[model samples]
Target: MSEENKLSVLVVGGGGVGTIVAVNLEAGGHAKVTLVLRSNFSKVSRDGFSIRSVDHGNLNGWRPHEVVDQVPAIGFGKPGFDTVVCCTKNIQDSTPSIEELIRPAVTPGYTTVVLIQNGLNIELPLVAQFPQNVILSGVSFMGSHEPEPGIIEHDFEDKLVVGAFRNPGTSAALSNARARDFVGHYSAGGKTVCEYTADANRSRWEKLVYNATMNPICAILRTDTATLRLSDSIENLVRPAMEEIRAAASANGYNLDASIAQRMIDMDPMEIFFKPSMCMDALKGNLIEFENLVGEPLRAGKKHGVAMPVLTVIYDMCKMLQWQLKAAREGRSQEDMLKVYDSGKP
Candidate 1:
């Protein structure tokens, strides 16, 4: 497809990362960026979104050409987007709804589905739905959030690595070319986009290691990345968890070096203050993506005879925390559980 024929783009999630990406795409001069919000978020009309990025300075006011709750029945009808970026959280129960929302934009020979979310499990299901078309998976290190409806705050500035997971070998030939082209376009327009490894599994595993180590701990303690990075007690807990993730990744045929984990932990702690997305979800009383981020890796590790006691403990704790938080949000008493975490009784 010629560059001119490429539909601007459609971003499915209207949360922090979604809004930031959409804003960046538009600011970079990509006009066809359409943000698809949930039907409940219909309040986010064509006025688009207002975003504030620490790195980009300020995007006080920004709007897209269209903002729809559901995909139009016409299936990429008029303002068809060349790329459909999925930034939804990985909640198993919500998969069907998300799939339905994604279907309309998957018109053959026109659009590519680029998933930019946490966890590694979303690739297969997404591909199962759109086999012939190009399905790309990406890992983002940027930290973003929506402080309120139609408003986003970008706290961290990081690079993005996009590639194909089904056929890792062919990712370079099949997706990298297009990815590079998109990256170049975005970069020219002042967005930070880069082509990292063609190996999606390795890339995903790398990010998983970082997530598994930081997200749960931060969520459980209600702290930011810096706290985790600076605290010896947190490090004691995080180091072991990261080690287990490394074991899991190694067992699953990915040769993740020990230094990768060290490098992630060793990064400057003060650069970013935003908490992990999982932590943010927990704060909002929303279900966390524990299964994919933590549970799946542990299961994969166990299947390969890898021991992950630290991860196992954190996983259980996070599950309980999520349950307690949900119950509290629903007006149930979580006093019993809070006593444990609050009084250091656990």
Candidate 2:
């Protein structure tokens, strides 16, 4: 294919997942790929991005066609990106908001927005704003992280589940061509497993069963998934929270089987040992993604009148912990913050 005829893609966030996608797309040599990185732009520009992965092998100095600081820097000069992949954390209070971050790249008529984010209802805002854009909801089970500024340590798993949003006003065929072509780009290498589903909402709920249960437990307990899986937390806390999530999804017109919880629990110990994003955020003093993961689902349960007592308690603990972290960052010492945080405790 001629260079002009090939797809032009822009990947936002430049984190673990972003680096993985950018590297693979460039390796495929089938698309015009550009990456938008913030602080790591200088390091990545100088040394390129490195990926240490069990699946993809050790790769160093992986460079894309172009690197920019933000979306506006990419002057696509046409309708902007044909495909925009978002790999950032879905923090509600983020300065760019997810909407603002992708606004510059998305072309209303043709761009396909791939949301590789976690939590429930994350695509709502984008779907509402860009009704004309083809929106694909994706759930990434890939284990990867940026240990430092420009290096990604990928443990395993390349399974990315993607599906179109069945919005009432949007046509299912709106960006079908772009979505299929984008998926084809990943089909070349056997290293990555990309599954295209008809129902992305169901996929999101399925991933949520595990994320909602383990992420908060790890964060609040200051432990890792391995520890949570081996302890009473699984039976007493994890299982019950999973059930609540299942119930909430069902109430929202999505059926999540009881087996998902066990399936996630049965994941290999290697995955269990790693810290989830929420736990890492808490430890790093970054804003925890409580709203989408816990708070949003809890609110949905209330709206549907479904009882989520187990999840409610877990949600409260996560919220309290987030506030405590915030207090610590606001110049209060950990000891003073803990005293105030635990004031009503026995």
- Top lDDT: which candidate number? 2
Give per-residue CA lDDT, model 1, range 141-258, as digits (tens): 8877777777777877846787765733234466766666566545545657556556777888898887876888888888877877777854588878888899899889998887
Badly placed stretches (over 4 Å) of model 1 are: 1-6, 39-43, 46-48, 76-80, 95-97, 108-110, 167-172, 271-274, 328-346
Which parts of model 2 have CA positions greater than 4 angstroms off? 73-79, 175-177, 270-272, 329-346
Q: Predicted candidate 1: what Cα RMSD to the true structure? A: 5.4
lDDT scores in order: 0.73, 0.81
- Which residue pairs show backbone clashes in model 1? none
lDDT for model 1, please. 0.73
